[model samples]
Target: MKKPDLISELNTAINQNIIIEKNIKEIIDMSFKIFKKLFDEFGLELEKLCDFKYSSYYSKHKNIDLDLAIVKYFPKKDVKYKEFLEKILDTLKNLPYGYKIRKEQNDGYIAISQETSSKIINYRFIFLVRKKTKTGYCDYYNRNGIWQEDYALELTKSFSLANKISNGTLYKVKSLLNYVLKDQFKYNYGCDAILITWFYEFFSRSLNKYLDNKYNKKEKELDFVNFTKIKNLKKWFKYNIDINNLYYFIFTKIGETNTYYYPELSFEPLELFEGITRYSVNTNTFFKLPLSYFSHIKVFDLRNYQDVRLIQEMGGEEYGYSKKAWSKARDEDKRYFVSPFIISGPFNYAMFKKWYVLTSNSLFKTLPVEIKKDLNSLRQRESMEFLNMTGHNWISSYYAKLKYLQPYFDKKYPLIKERDLKVLIRMITTMVDKTKQSDWLLENDN
Candidate 1:
């Protein structure tokens, strides 16, 4: 598309309400008003409210259709948090654009929607919540003056924990997180201040850029005027952190025109997280929550919306793990990979690990001696550098389930599609047959 045409199309969308553009500063100001209301109503400490800054924004088309204006909140305790939630709901229920409650149990929502000739749509005002989990989420990364990297297996465990928390949240927990963050980040001094302040500023800035990229007709064009590429290590991570690409799928499958362009205030407890990041493939520059800047902060897909169906239908509570994506064992062989679903078509970190193991074991056998020696000499990172979409001759592994990459595979290894598929299937089959991956495969495989 021509540059002029693209701009004209974007302009037309805005004029027709097909697309809505805002000077991002306006978004920041409007979102703060919502936070201010929460702070005043809860009587939260003024200092903490000051700490809360505009972090990011996201819009989803699902049970709730709203723009989630994310703010960074730090709280000290759950002090009367439950009461604050009750009051907020009661107050909003009386307002003109307030959400109408859909489900009031542990999992439910209150939404504000527009009525059209065909039906009511453009739902917003979703407040999702969750019971405090015992997952490895470190409330304070340096609470006891211990750094995460110094401990054994601590880093990986933290990544795993982050993966768990970012999953979609149910209702009833949104108000608690929103109202309680003031206490979450208030600091005394020294390391506590360093960590907390670091957490607040990085996310406030990172998410700001990440949220602004929604305007691209194809990929989100980097708003260069607003975002700068990360070059300094002071705020950068010590190690490469993995980020989940699930939103790519959600947007492809569910995101539609008009439903999300206009900002309708929403309260989803889940995606508002401050630590998440989205690394750009087009540019090494990053845009996302800065949590990944911490070497130990690995991103995992938290498909929370997947759980709502089970929660609403049964409400009985006994259905348990039976409701998770991994609950169906039979579907693993055919339907597990999630990367192919993203607009970027990225693969999971696990798939890269699998390819490494398989190549070392058999795929590289008798490779001309020079090639074999040279390949073997490469480190894990070196090996992976040659495997990404931008990398040379990368194969479409069975794990990615990317039928779209079949042409690439066919061109590289003509007439071997069946063999490649079989080998890939065998790799996963052996994994399932030999290891205790039933749960891991269920939760993160997709």
Candidate 2:
């Protein structure tokens, strides 16, 4: 079926608060302005030629809105990447919306060299969603105005700009077109024309959805994995591994079967960010890092932990003296028991700290030599980023990192009242700190 020519509808959609399908074409047309501006800057070399065969303009364009666009560059001879990246950033300063660089990423001495081989970076920038807004969202939002949550951050992932260097599925045509643009350049504009056709049939829905289906469905989706399922517990008895840092409990609701690791339900709530995927606007599929992979976790259900703790203290008093009292305590603390496995050998707290965002460091000093070596080896000196989402380094503790994401979370999901989010962050941070103190395996690190 042929899609309607929605140019005018798209224009209307652009000005409205809530965007609809009709507005897509207009947004794509507007995005080309960026392309043209870029071409004017780089097209000078190929001016003498009739046309250039290889180009990103052909492969990369708008996915839904300008939210997704390819911004690739190849500097002319003697032009350095530092000059290129900075110049492009300066261009963003001229836009009507606000554009700020992440302070932790590049600042001060700027030790990270811009000239390194092809760097594919995903940059995010904010824009004015409602014409009615008189101020940036952080300050205030007028009752009549609105913030366009979905379109706030425009995601731009770059490809290698280095010539003669293509990595993993990249082709020579993928390089920024420089020399031979007019006469000698490659003209294999293979699937360029079909982009619109493909957009209508397939890409109208984000591709990330397809990739997500086959994977572990964001490990957080499961209420709680069984307490026995973590990596090294089976060997605890045989190898004298310390398991006291592990907090054990089952979070269950009457008639409901979801198992939980902590008493509190949520600590770091998920949020959608602009610039990642399309349906992210329509779903809770935010926060690219899976909960299973997130280290330094603090159990949030404090009320239950306290109740269970009281039962534990009263019951363990008669462990050797009264079998009846001991049995009762075991049953009472069944849902929330502090881990009981005492590790006698050296526990590797240092390595765990280096690789994870753990709140407790007590286990690091006593870890065995072999485990310490493993943790040190998995240091992962580089950044850990995937699916266009990156972690924050501005925080001091593992839990603080999630706490710091509050503003971004509120901006992405406005219905979530800001006050509640703030409270949750604070509560979770406090609970985790306490959990670390209570679970400080050293009490039984024997």
Global lDDT scores for all candidate models? 0.25, 0.23
> For residues 1-446, could you state the per-residue lDDT of candidate 1 as single tens digits?
43232222322322332111253334434533654475456443211111111111111122212222111134444324344446546655543453244522231223344433333332222221212333222221111222121111222222222223222110111111222221111111111111222232233333333333343223434434233233322122212111112212221221111111111111112111113232223321111111111221111122334433433342211211222222321243212111100001111112222224443334344244554344446443443233222111112121122121223223234433343333433343344335432222223211
Q: How many clashes does each candidate structure show, in the order listed?
A: 18, 18
Q: Highest TM-score among the candidates is held by which one?
A: 1
Error of 1 at 255 (Å): 23
Encode model 2's per-residue lDDT on 1-446: one tens digit a residue. 86332222222322231122334433434433543464356431111100111222221212111112112322223233345345545554453332223421121111111111222222222111222222222111111122112210110001111111111112122221211111111211111111111111121111122223422243223222332232322221113311111100100121121122212111123332222222212222232221110011111111356544544443221111222322433554322122211101111111112223321132233445554454434431211121111212111122222122233223334422433433443443344335532232223211
Q: Give all candidate RMSDs, comma-separated.
A: 25.3, 27.7
Sliding window of 10 residues with minimal summed lDDT for model 2 = 243-252
Model 2, which residues run further than 4 Å from truth? 1-20, 32-35, 42-79, 97-446
Model 1 TM-score? Answer: 0.24
